[model samples]
Target: MTYLNTRGSRVSIRMSKESDLTVLVIGSGGREHSLVKICLNSPIVSKVIAAPGNGGIATEAECHPVQVDDPADIVSLAQRVEASLVIVGPEVPLAAGAVDALEAVGILAYGPGKAAAQLEASKAFCKDFFARHGIPTAAYGTFSDVDSALAYLDTQSYPLVIKASGLAAGKGVIIAENREEAASTVQEMLSGAAFGDSGRQVVIEEFLEGEEASIHIMVSGEDYLMLPPSQDHKRIGEGDTGLNTGGMGAYAPASIITPELEQEIRDTVIRTTIDGLMKDKLDYRGTLYIGLMLTDAGPKVLEFNVRFGDPETQVILPLVADDLVDIFLKCARGDALPDKLNLHPAYSMVVVLVASGYPGSYPKGDPISLPDQLMRSATLVHAGTKINPEGELVTNGGRVLGVIGTGPTLKISAEKAYALVDQVIFSTKVFRKDIGWRQLERKPHKA
Candidate 1:
């Protein structure tokens, strides 16, 4: 299969457009549920399979139980299912060489290999990669010893950002407002009390002041395709206060990222990063979750995740209309993307419902009940849910469900999402009331 290159001459490529293909998605989160939903919409997807899927996903795919972290286990399952394409949804598997295992056995998979996953697995490596490529990012330092870190902190000013070099499930980042807090947090992280081995090495950097946004790009060598811009509320409390969780809520396309800024990001950040990866000869494929801080000077990369973001994917995939299975297949096969990505002409928002004490220890196995009287268009994408022996739905993880709403306007979409959230009940339910608050305040514009 091939298409005329919009930039220059025509390009030919080896492609397979099999109409009867089975897609195996790996993960058990709302993001995986969204991937399953999108793949099911494709005409070529005869079956969608999710390993260790949540309750909602089980309704859509053939759910199988498997250890997600072991590459061998994932490879065995893919072989048993005879999957033509595999789409990985979480970062841990990608970091564990799941894609490498799949490809080694002649199975097509969408994700970066272990070598490229170092961008997310280790913050120190990412900072070095950015510095090596001259990518615009915050100035930073990496330290493994408390004495060296403290000695370096004395020369710096107040209000710094401290991060664990390894993955900590998104709770490894801490913003120290002053010197005293920075010192203690560094000690805690280095002492192995907070994040364990993930915090063994820490990266302290100058705090960037700007509104943050999430950008997704499907990269195949030098070629790439950008998704609609989105923003997520990471803080656990409303009005951006308290400890950060994976994410509370999200909406797309973000109004804060203007058309000019979007184009600039495409040129400076996405294009430059992909080209740099190609030049370095790293076999990087799959999704690139570029967390960007739109500073007054320009856009600077905050961090990179080798997989789709959680609540952000919950919001963004609903706005996409193209066959996601086709897109993932092309990306996995290193084929050029279409000139334009398809998306619905509307706003979408997702509100996450978590158990009380989330981003911390939370109770599980609480029976969940849904309102049967209400009829709405919102989608309840489940993340941490399970079926009891009595056939009742129960809470099973920190973040339970992602309630999605879509409409012609941001306010309407948010209202619908919140309304759907209100109908769901559990033993100890928690959610943010102000999802998409920033977008609601801004003047309406074309998304």
Candidate 2:
């Protein structure tokens, strides 16, 4: 596909094996590893490179061994290698406007631009956006002062969720179910006792009922492509109890939205969201992630991730049938491609193994013993580990790896997930047992 600029110059991509284009994958985690794995599988890819990749990702691509957040270095590397397409995985770069910077140098990048990124960076902005766009989300009211928030909370029901407006590395949210609990939570935010400056302003939203689900859509301006629905287990313990970590596990396609139901969401929320951004003069390009809650009435948008969600990305990428490069370019050019994108007919589940005491502080540097032939048996995408000078693998961060299992039936996939979980050995390893408990009961129709 060729896209022309305003000056009548043609913008073309190199998608063949003999292509001159190089691939630069930003961010180092299981999510980025999943992307790098997908890109490496592409016959169209010539060279795959990662900036400061982890120990697990180093095996997949040529590791650049530089800081992931250094935008100047990122741009310099792009220019040095003449990268054809740059894919960003984490939210920090997107919030930092790496796409805007890369594009300023004529590099095509996947992910939304900076102006479109405030939807994820600021919860207050997103709540207002939901109200303005009629996006069908949980009831929310924003506040800068704790007194106003506390005053508003007393009039409302128990069990409300308070969120920090800025990035808190997934630990910015607090769910308080009682008067005392809510008061303490407000004090924590207002006094800067938690989440630091991220808590300067808080978004207190009505605690939503019903199950949680994740929906990722590829957007080319107003045109959108929806992936198979997946449900992620956020809480650390079984039966969905315990403090919320990043994500324990995920599985798809969720039985929540059938074809008839999905089409309704596309018409209402998904399409309307992209159209709203454009109407509001926000040029939202690339992927738009809508984390939703399937309630009694219908689906309600829980949060908007301008980029892909971590554990969610681990499972969704395996099911996609279209060439990732092909879809990305199509979206970047703002052209509507085929609506009938294919996915694997089977179900896939990803169980994330985390260190003990996560969503707080956890121990690191634990050795991991993983079996070979992951892609053939279960896909292993590393999140936090580094290779030492002695070539020994050591834990570098929490949320270690996504052990994925794929099969025709959800039961078989779950079985495979647990089976693979048994093979890996790590001290203080923890994962939720029942990842796909809800949707597996209902017979799936269409994602």
Candidate 3:
């Protein structure tokens, strides 16, 4: 397949090893690893490269050392590698206009530009946009100083949520249990004592109650593809008891979101958001992650992520039946997307293993041991691991790895994932035992 360039030159679409369709994935986390894996599975993808990839990713794709923060470095690397499709995985680069930089050089990039990334980069902006569009979200009040936020907190009820307006790597939101905690949290955020510059401004919102489901979508000028819904366990401890972490574990095809509930989300939240973006003239492209709270009233927006979720991606990608490289290429090229995504009728689960005392301070450089082959239904996706001097895989960050399992049933998937989790050995490796607890409580879907 080929298309005519703007300058009237012929540009052939790279479809396989015969073509020069080199894909460059930007990030060094589990999400990027999943993207690399999905792309490699595509028959149309000739080659895939990851920038600053981790140890496990090194085995799958060619790992190149490049700074994700610097748009110039990312663009230069993509150009040097002659990447046909550049998928920006992390939010920082997209917020920094890396996609714009790639498009500026005539490269097809997947992700929103800087202007559209405010949906995730700035919480205050997202709230304001939600209000303007009448999208269903928790009522929010933005404050730039401590005094005003304190006054606002006094008027609000207990069990409120306060958020740092800027990105803080997913640790910026605080659910205050009472007035005292809310006041202290407000001061901590506004004074920049908690998250530095990212906490200069804060958004205090109503505490919503209900199940949270993540909706991943690919959009191009209003054309959209909705992937299967997934739920993530965010807290560190079991039964949702500990401080929040990036995400502990996740499962796809969340049965809690019934067919009716999914349509409600599509009609009220997803459609409204896309229409609002078009009305605002954002020219939004790439993934729009809708973090939704399925309240009794309806599905409400909890937050938005410009890129794919980490543990969620690890589970969701396995359910996708289409060629990932082909989908990304079509989306990046501004082609019409399939009305509905093809999802396998199976449950996929990912259990994240973290080092001890994670979401705070934890130890690194510990040796890691893994079996030669996992169980038939399991896959080990690396996140925060690197090759040591002795060429051994060692723990390099808080979240160590994600073990993904797929099976005909959710129970089987969880069993497979936990079985693989036991195979990974690290000195302080920690993980949750109950990943799909809620899903398990619900009856399995009848075929």
Candidate 4:
């Protein structure tokens, strides 16, 4: 697919140029910014473009002015540039069938189809998928009527997981500590006014006590390839206190899974999901993130995402040594992965810097200070940020930059992450101090 170059020079292109691959990444967040950086570093990738990107992204990729939520603009951008790949970084585009749209026009997209993305769009669909695939997960029931949900809650346990059935942008989930709290959660979700259409229905599940881990697996049709495991802190305050935001911080190489358990996870959860997608004839591309609860009984599925995780991506992408653009192109074409996709075996930690009164409403337009080039050793991935017409960088979303650090060990990574974060300044910036404490014992779940 050759398009006239900006200068009207003849450039041979095959769908997208594998060498100097012109890639268009969708979404305006730290994850997409991290993706842009990784792709730009690829020896084969020549250019990186982001649609409706944040301030940090503009520094790395040519920022294209298109709304992330509008799939038509995204597809048109890719078609116009003859981009080789369209990598989606958020759930909204996946649910909007952006992948289907891009592929329909001869452009390869790295996102799940609408059928597969339903796993992320609807919690109720995730539960149904788990049940249908025979994948182990916490028992749950869905409800659309308010009274039925209230009545069903009478027999359930405390410390329940309450989730809005439709997309809620990570804020739809609530972990209630008591029966009273659980009931209140049910009431709020079914009330149909709290989360808008997202709360039209809800899923209430028995809480499983376990350490949580985030795992992303690249799927090419029936083939499944797993990435290094990562863990994200979703709570807002230190020690995981306060309300749940999108994500507070994250770290990779969590000792939660031993080599033996890692294989078990693949055989049970990851493999089963791929098989299910194949059986249903659903074409899956890009990455599928499975949020797991390693319980005493076993590893249980918590949630699914059609794209790479946010803070998790901040840590995971830095550890990868392979040319990401090449891998993405291969996956798009249904080519088998190399036997080994090399990843640096280092402890990568990411901390999300949020504004004051965030996850509610906070101040914007504050000029965030970026460290000088020498002091800016850490990668500050832009999430919620935008440039004012006056050229001042300001906050645009609740979660801001993803402060990422890679080191010899988790402790070293943590130190580097916080040190870099300290050099930067934002008004009422809040972050969690206990980022990797959960894995401090080196004790795996007793399953």
Indicate the residue-level lDDT of 386 in model 1.
87
Better of 1 and 4 by TM-score: 1
lDDT of 3 by residue, 1-447 (tens): 565533333434434453457889999999999999998887767889999899899989999999898999999999888888899999999999998888777777889899999999999999998998889999989999888888998899879999999999988988899999999998888888999999999999999999888899988767889888899999899987788999999998888888889888888988888899989988777898999998888899988999899989999989998877777776676667777788888999999999999989999999999999777889999999999989999999999999999999898999889888988999999999988888887655521
- Give a tens-digit lDDT track for model 4, residues 1-447: 544322232323454334757788888888889889988898887778888788988877788787667778888888877787788889998898887778767676777877888989988988998899999999999999978888888888788889899998787888888878888878877887779889989999988888889798887776666788988888888787878888999888777777888989988998888888877777677799999999988899988888898889888888888877777776676666676668886888888999888889988888887877624336788898888888878888788788887787887788888899888787768777788777654555321
The most accurate candidate by TM-score is 3
Q: What are the lDDT figures for the candidates, one per model? A: 0.87, 0.80, 0.88, 0.81
TM-score of each: 0.93, 0.92, 0.95, 0.92
Candidate 1 total steric clashes? 0
TM-score, candidate number 3? 0.95
TM-score winner between candidates 2 and 4? 2
TM-score between candidate 1 and the true structure: 0.93
C-alpha RMSD by candidate, in order: 3.6, 2.7, 2.5, 4.7
Which 10 successive residues of model 1 have the least lDDT summed? 6-15
Candidate 3 accuracy as lDDT: 0.88
